[model samples]
Target: MYRGRLAYRPRSETANKIREVNKMKEGIHPNYYQAKVVCNCGNEFVTGSTKKDIHVEVCSKCHSFYTGQQKAAAARGRIDKFNRKYGIQ
Candidate 1:
């Protein structure tokens, strides 16, 4: 739940049946097709070896706050949830 609302609830089988009237979609992205990824920082490089540009929004050298941004966000969210649950805030 989030802000007094369900974040993820299973959809009913009937809900799945309803389809969009306009069923149009694009193909795979061309950039993703490329085997190599060059970070804007020009400090690091990633290839198919590392499971494709992942776990990072930007390279460490380019981003103002690198390495712990994702971790910090998650920590803050968890702390907020705990506070709400225990009236600690």
Candidate 2:
């Protein structure tokens, strides 16, 4: 027994004709402009987006995963309680 190779399915003539008739009208879609991303660590880069500008808290420059510096983020009250209960230094 031999397995048959997969074949490409050509588009139907009616589908092609319908696509030609139903062409998209221009000037209706939203404008896509360049957006600037600013990170807290002073990293900035330009990218394409629907919005004109974007602000972010973290980026490749300051992210712990990228920088290899992990800092524990704990609330003030939670840190105090945990330290007091566990007597952690």
Candidate 3:
């Protein structure tokens, strides 16, 4: 019986080389700087972005999907359609 021993695989040398070489040229790309994100719920955080400052309607701290508070806004639309079909105010 012939058996082969397991061998460790080495990382590829050119794995991320393409990305490094294709980086944006200096002064041509948008300026990346520290920007502040202000959420409507008063949650503020600093992150790196091209804009100096950003205002977001929702964030992880207060977003419906993240906080498990999602409401069916589509349900209101359905209700409106039903009312229109039935001529109900």
Candidate 4:
């Protein structure tokens, strides 16, 4: 509903008929290309995309979650902060 007005929706039969009669506009969609994705950690992969080339800083190969390093680093930071605040070695 818009502005408290009931929304208009076609019935199932009408909707099916409209779908059969209408079709997607040609030449309006971007072309899919075999895109080359380059990661900062030297990881490269090919995937379908509208763009031909893509550059990224991180990839699954070196991501902290994939390597299981983010949690350790975060915990170490918290522990250090707590220790400093309490003047503990």
Candidate 5:
């Protein structure tokens, strides 16, 4: 990023258009978009609902609730509604 007098003066109309295009690219698809967050200490890694792998550092198996271990980990309100609707135990 150029700053102060070092910034591109854009003397020509073409130069201005080029600068604008560059700005738009920076505005979208930023650098961090490619980096999926891996859980730091073997907890869980999730990219929205798209991906889950267990037992590895970011796996679903190691996550406390995902494997359904800690008692009835699911929230009671949602579970009751689901059971009532689907006749699930």
Candidate 6:
């Protein structure tokens, strides 16, 4: 025991062997469907998901970052203002 709790120990291979095939309960898990995704930029793709149809505002096809259309902001903060004011290199 360490830190008031028992430490983890690996079990032997024979001890970890299972005799029965464990199966998932039917009707309990959500049904996976070939989900249709529609983006606002008119990009469509099919993927597996619990939801049938999905609508998104932005996707990789039209996102500014993915499309390389993102603009870098000329962000000047207090440090920059101070440096410029004092003419610090």
lDDT of 6 by residue, 1-89 (tens): 45787779887665555422355567899889999999999999999999999999999999878876554322446667789999997
lDDT of 1 by residue, 1-89 (tens): 45886679888766666655335566643334323556655555555642454444466566646665777888899999999999995
The C-alpha TM-scores of every prediction are 0.29, 0.54, 0.50, 0.74, 0.24, 0.56
lDDT of 5 at 58: 44
Pairs of residues at least 3 apart in sequence or in different chains that clash in candidate 2: none
Clashes of 6: 0
List lDDT for all candidates, in order: 0.63, 0.86, 0.86, 0.95, 0.58, 0.82
Q: Looking at candidate 5, what is the lDDT of residue 29?
A: 55
* Residue-wise C-alpha lDDT for candidate 3, range 13-72, written one tens digit per residue: 686787688887887777799999999999999999999889999899987778764556
Instruction: Extract clashing residue pairs from model 6.
Output: none
The stretch of ten residues in a row with the least summed lDDT in candidate 5 is 46-55
Model 2 agreement with the true structure over 1-89: per-residue lDDT tens digits: 76988889999999999999899878998889999998888889999998998999999998877776563443556788999999997
Model 3 misplaced stretches (Cα beyond 4 Å): 1-24, 71-89
Weakest lDDT window of 10 consecutive positions for candidate 3: 67-76
Flag clash pairs in model 5. 53-59, 54-59
Candidate 5: Cα lDDT at 49: 31
Off by over 4 Å in 6: 1-21, 72-89
Question: What shift in Å separates residue 35 of candidate 4 from its native position after superposition?
Answer: 0.7
- Give the per-residue Cα lDDT of candidate 3 at 63: 77
| Best candidate according to lDDT | 4
Ranking by lDDT: 4, 2, 3, 6, 1, 5
| Residue 53 of model 5, lDDT score | 36
lDDT of 3: 0.86
> Over 4 Å off in model 2, which ranges?
1-13, 21-28, 71-89
lDDT of 5 by residue, 4-87 (tens): 565665499988888888764545553433234456464434443333432345455556767676556557777899999999
RMSD (Cα, Å) of model 3: 7.3
